[model samples]
Target: MAADRRVAEGLEHLKEAEKCMKTSFFKWKADYDGAASAYTKAGTCFKSAKSYDQARQAFLKAAECNVQNNVMFHAGKAYEQAGMMCKELNDLNRAAQLIEKAGHLYREHGVPDTAASTFDRVAKLLEPTNPQKAVDYYLIGSDITECEDRPRQAADFQKKAAKLLVRMGNYDRAVEVLKVEKKFQIEGENAPEVSRVTVELVLCHLARGDFVAADKAYKDAYGIPGFTESDHCRELAELLDAYDENDQDRLSSVAARPMFKFMDNDYAKLARGLQAPGGGEGGKKKKAALLDEGIEEGMEKGQLENQEVGGEDEDEFEGGLC
Candidate 1:
């Protein structure tokens, strides 16, 4: 009964807020600020009454009213509240959308730190269900941090995005994000982090069955100062060697290392699935077949060469010049 009373009170406040938006001869300008305040009250009451849907609608109305009043910070906050209500209602998709809008509003209001944080929050929330969208938001957060000259923070966001992409089996995009993350680490003068990211880049290539790119990534890491001296470089070297030698046993050992195990969940999953190029019994059979083909071709060439020499000798003998 108390909750029902609160709901009725919320509806009355909502009506009052709506009435404030209507133009009248006595009011030359709409009372947007007053409407926003009333709508915010309505939202709070509805939320307190556990009416999430009505609370969400009220908060969204507050956000629009704040926007019309040119109060962007308040508008962003209102949108954030609406997003929380959506989360309470288990409407994650709408929650993500509203929170993203709040982030954009915060950015436009010249509060980039808040915007970046908002973006990051929404991205993490969406990670389990919509990884692609999570990657997009993470990248947006990375860009915002980068623009703020926060290289370390930017690299963190990029790393998160890269891992998600790797999980989705989007190795190409993962490599791209890892490259950007490496650049950020470089700009931050973090040699160890750069090396670590480079290792991830190489693993991404390898996971995609692109040994050439993986080798190139390893070689490219040498250009980064101190990368050659880092443990990551050595790990990469062993991993590459195992793949090149098609040594499945060695590959498994390398992939099971503590470093691989300590990586993010997605990267760890990738590492666990790493296989030597031309791995397994099937790969061994293929290698044996190729070797046999090469040997047979070489023998045929040798035989032809001998036949030519014999013919030359016969010609010389026929001419009495042997």
Candidate 2:
């Protein structure tokens, strides 16, 4: 009871601070710094009062004030704080959005590393619910990392984006993103990165149900020096051979083989879905149907788990057809 009373008192103080912040904003023209200071005070009070939602809003208001004053660096920090509060509230989409705002501000302020890192976090947050958005954030991060002369980091982000693209059945886009991996390759040298990218491209093509393109990607990767040195690479070669020969039995055998354990789950799931009865026979609608069935199944499983754990249901966010 005492704790509740203390919280109520703190909330009253926060409300007073918020009123002062608003008065500073409207009554004093060009006093953005004063308003920002008031907003920060209000945010602190909101935090003390355990009003996280209000705290996030107050910090965002401060960020807006800083942005209006062209103090973008400070504004970016404020936005990051708001994003952290959103994370604490378990509002991942909102957090990702806030962080993305911070990332843009940081980039505009010439803070490449911070911008890249912020965008990476945004991508990670969006990955489970909105993979296309995740891919977009990852690509942005990759661009920033590449500009910072970090090819390996750039390739890593690009690869992650490609993986999501493949899962979303945007194989063409996946291939395009994976091509960025070649930027890390040295001329006239055997680079494992190059082979790795080619293998991913093969998977993308296969996921798109394009055996011809998959064959080309596979052969290209297989011809690379030291490609077969890796056991996994050899397995990929055998899989490609099966695909080339149009041998359904061999394809199924290889897909089921433990040697393919290194395959990404998204790739495996997509492959299984495509190979199912009447799968890959129709056009985009057919693909969407398959995806919907999988989504429904997943939702059912998630609901069951939630019931078992006595947790509130989480909202689902679906991305557009890739």
Q: What is the TM-score of each candidate against the true structure?
A: 0.82, 0.70
Compare the candidates by lDDT and give the number of the best one. Answer: 1
Backbone clash count, each prediction separately: 0, 0
Tens-digit per-residue lDDT, 1-322, candidate 2: 6545545665564555455456454476555777677677766666666678877988998899898889998899888889888988999888888899999999989999999988988898888888999999999998898888888888888878988898788878987887776554433243777876776677677767787887776666666777768755776777766665555555566676664445678766644443412332334454578899999999999999878666432322244344
lDDT (10s digit) by residue, model 1, range 205-297: 998889999899899878888878777888889988878878777788889999888987888889889877654454466578999999999
Clashing pairs in 2: none
Candidate 1 at 229: error in angstroms? 3.3
Residue 302, model 2: Cα distance from true site in angstroms: 64
